[model samples]
Target: MKPIRALSNADEVVRLLGSEGDMSPAEIAERLDIPRPSVYRLLDGLESIGLTESVPGSRARLNLRWLHLADQARESMVEWAGARELLSELVERTSQTAYLTVLRGHEAVCLEWEQGRAVGVLLLKPGRSLPLYAGAAGRTCLAFGVNVEEYLDTVTERRAYTADTLTSDAALRADVEATRRRGYVFSDEDVTDGIAAIGVPIRGSRGQLLGALSVSGIKVEYLAKRDAYLEALLDVAGRLASLNEAAIQ
Candidate 1:
């Protein structure tokens, strides 16, 4: 059996578990092309670090204690509290539903949301997940300062939710390019019929893509005053980005 180094062995085990989910030492060894004895030793070390846990008769699973640590790291972002305050302000100003979003793997997840005075507007709640190519927030996130081709390739297998959704590679790529140039994106009856949304990317202190901020309302009301709404959306996005930068610094 080859002698296993600690860092390389631990990383190999983590990659195996992450991609293949829970598995026994023998299974991990087979997948990693490592010795079974070495795999068991690595698993023991991982369990000691609180990164993996073993079940008596079942396969070992990721401990998820590190997830708590990840959340803590996210919360340490200097701008989180200020971003929430700005979101609230934007919702109040527009009287349309507003949200703050962040990318989570192949999806966008709402981190904050506020409902305006609009009667029937959809109220997105925190933790709501959306397809990376389906909604305004997702489109904005995918288009803003990211490799459009890479993102499209990653999300190609996912189904579009609406007929108007940009599922085709060419169309989606074009949309992404346009969004990057215009600095925002608009979705009319794309995610849901009778609904319209406008979104702008929020950037962090180091110019990292924070996520997106969007305002949504009924299609009829939105279309009648599209230009005005676009301006408002851009204004809010800029303010939120600035707020995030300041808070972080």
Candidate 2:
């Protein structure tokens, strides 16, 4: 059998610990499909570097170094410094899950979220992302954040997330036109059944695309209160846009 590359194995161990939390060497080895000895070697190296630490019951988990790294990452997103408070306010007003998303490559990445009482299950959350054509937030980015022609050229395949997902190029083009015309997206069962979302583009003071603000809830409830929700989203987005770049930094 070929030997596993130590660097790649070590990196995979870190990602696994991040997603699955603490695990024993054997557990990590089983999950990675590598030998137990290799797992131990990777864990030992990570512990030596203060990246992972041993826990009770022979488990190893990522240590405080990751917390520092996470804080640094958070600090870099200056535009979102006050997002937690703003999203909390949105959740209070609408009683639905509120999300802050930014376009990264061809995906819409959820940077932050506030869960509400009305909707407990969610497809997008902090650290998760969706394809640019699959959900309200994603479609908003597709419509406003990139060159439509170049983006379309790069899409090799579009996966259907649900029965209502728009996978065809013509459908996506029409959706983009509508999103630009209306200034928001009303996603109905495109990502998850019984779920719907409204997404609006947020721009900087200079009208530069900043990100997306979205709220999601039960389909029927969202449709019934669509106008009110859109008003709330636009209001908050306006405030977010008004934030001074120099002040945020």
Candidate 3:
């Protein structure tokens, strides 16, 4: 919420709109924990830049033009993050689909993904938005980068997607701490039953979290290849982070 972080907040606002569809200024301010006036000003800047649009009394949504930029951003980030080749290697090694996702506001946005020949799986499609609380991707974002308490408090929809989903505050906080300590995260049957995923946060040399690399498969398959998946994610973390800042600049 500081003035210096305005651009970062603006970037997050775009991701927020993507996750929630569309929102009023009041809704945005509430979700983002920023003042209404600041939200309005932010919205104004976005509109000026043609990233979003609002009718007088309606909720503001990302302009269609934003989609074009989003597509470009994806291509741009993949190249700089060195994620393309690494994701390919991941799928080849584990025969499970791999994903590279960025922590976007209260959700993790899929930036790039590759399919595996193992089980014909295809869940984490590009552009899909997932919760930043219940999956391996969420664990990395929560543990490594974001304001955990603020994220926990603001996110209202804690749907128990499956029997294994962790919805309690205490359980989730404990998992977050554990992820930090272990330097990785694993979610089994949390987002989807019969599927499991392992994730490692990608950090820059300066220790800033860039995003996460996760691989998912049928639970048995993932468990068998867990060690390999962790190693693959670790191998590219530095490359992704080192080039991410340059990509954005």
Candidate 4:
């Protein structure tokens, strides 16, 4: 039997297994049209690296060790000290939840969050991952006009979490257009029903998009005072972006 590496099918097998969850060698072989023995050999190598683990009475499953590397890479973005302080101030001033997030592997991960005074509002914690197709943070990142078409393609399969979620391609395009025109993104019941959010892009010194800073709250109060909240949200976003740019210098 030929070695898995010599057959040039090792990586594909690993990817298939990682994506499809636990599967026996025969199942992986059937899916990839490779010999079962080759799949087992590839799994052996993957297991040695701690990227794959054997499930009792089942095939190997993907391990989360790669996530540690991914987290390190994500944190390599500009230091969060200044940005987090500013975000905390924004939340204190507005008395609304504020979040700092960056695009991470097709999702927006909250790097920081400041709690609002609103009772019963859903609290977002640091390290929480949100879908790229929903919420103000995601839209703000998407509206930054950096390879947007490619990013949209990558997020096309995201499931809508609410009735107001922009699931259609055309609608998402339109939303992005509106967000670009407004210089920010706003959402009402898009991610969670009865929630509202507004966000703007944060750019680095060279004008590279660093992330998004957003203010979010419950729907009722937001609707009653939408314009005022919009102003505050935009103000904080602009301020944060400027601070980041200056710090990156």
Candidate 5:
């Protein structure tokens, strides 16, 4: 089915404002390749719904409505009620930043994180996201989640963030296979230089893929404690899964 032109343009407007910050309707029109008049209508519609607010310089930006929605969204994830403590525990054991990410469409969304003593330029903070081929958390989720081949078909671009980042389809598929074999991912400076991460899948009681659990830090420190970190991740992921199952029961 074909997309509705107005709705598609409106969605692009929201995404543009979100990613590029405040922008005038003309700027949005130019960026999105839509008509300036259509941009005005979209902005008006969004502002009427309190999704966008006018700032100085005739620019528009997403408003506090998103924060309210975000709060509601966070509260809805009842199964993850005690996940923060678990991530903190993982951080304590490994001295590396711990992340909990769930696959959302084509991206891995970081739902939560616990900063560690050895934290570097961590990228998987809460609310941020990564392509499924990029980070440890993303790769682990991609490997363990359903319809792996279908997901690969949707990926048109495999961007390389660093020298070690896998940009080829074969390399990504190989990494996914390796992750399935080992039950975890050992990402060595894949997303960012000097940063390494270890990832393991979190499953529910019915063996459904729930999310990914990961720890990241400086390369040498991460590699040095690789075995211990993997053990800690697996232990915490199991506990989290049990918690979710018990919640449902």
Candidate 6:
């Protein structure tokens, strides 16, 4: 692998170790198909930052300290400039939880979300991240963020999170095209069952893709006020698009 790619492999290793806990260096190397020495180096770096811990028999466990750090980072980003107030306005106006997300290496990572005064699962809450090929927010990012077909080619599994998920590459491509044409995305029970989401791409003042602005709620609730909700989401996205880079990060 190229040195740059190898450097990034550490982050993928971190995510894997975080999700699948208590893995030995050998096991992690096998899972990632990298060298054992590289795994040890990545583990050493993670350990220095307190994101992982050595277990019995030289295994590694994801430390809870990472979650605390994540929480702090989320808090700081939310409180950054206009983010918190905008998300709050979005939630209050739509009565559905609103989320702001950014694309991090083909994955859409949630930066912040605001709970609305409605009943919903909130499965894609803040700090959670997912593949850009799935969900409304992720699809919006896929459509406007990069070349959809090329990006999906790099993803390994296109697993269906629900019956409505677009699993086939052709279907995903079509969906991305439609999202581009519509300038937003509308999804029902695609990522999480019983939840519906509508999203639009948020671009910076210079037209750089900042992230996605999405609002999710129970499907029944969405069906009842789809038009009004779509309008509100579009308005929120427009406002988000006008934000400065300093205020957006």
Candidate 5 regions exceeding 4 Å error are 1-5, 120-122
Worst lDDT 10-window in candidate 1: 119-128
Regions of candidate 1 where Cα sits further than 4 Å from its true position = 1-77, 120-123, 205-207
- Over the stretch 129-212, how does candidate 6's per-residue lDDT look in tens digits? 877878878888888888776776778587788889887888888998898888888888899888898888888766768889
Best by TM-score: 5
Better of 5 and 6 by lDDT: 5
**Candidate number that wins on TM-score, 4 or 6:** 6
Q: Go through the candidates in order and give each one's C-alpha lDDT.
A: 0.77, 0.89, 0.82, 0.76, 0.87, 0.82
Taking the candidates one at a time, how many backbone clashes does each contain?
A: 0, 0, 0, 0, 0, 0
Q: Encode model 4's per-residue lDDT on 1-249: one tens digit a residue.
A: 556454468677766865577888888889989888767878888789788889987678878886796668646766565766777778777778888898776777788787887744453556666766689888877777346688777766878789898878788789888988888787888988888887877776566778888888888877787677777766776777677666557
TM-score of 5: 0.92
**Stretches > 4 Å off in candidate 4:** 1-77, 120-124, 204-207
lDDT of 5 by residue, 37-130 (tens): 9889889988999999999999999998998888788778998889999998998898888999998988899988888897565566877799
Q: Please, what are the lDDT tens digits per residue for candidate 3 over residues 39-144? A: 8999999999898999657689989996787678776654455668878977887788788888888878788888877665455667886787778887788889
From the highest TM-score down, the ranking of the candidates is 5, 6, 2, 3, 4, 1
Pick the winner on TM-score between candidates 1 and 2.
Answer: 2
Off by over 4 Å in 2: 1-68, 244-249
- For residue 180, model 4's alpha carbon misses the true position, in angstroms, by 1.1
TM-score of 4: 0.68
Q: Which number leads on lDDT?
A: 2
The RMSD (Cα, Å) of candidate 3 is 6.2
For each candidate, give its TM-score against the true structure: 0.66, 0.77, 0.70, 0.68, 0.92, 0.81
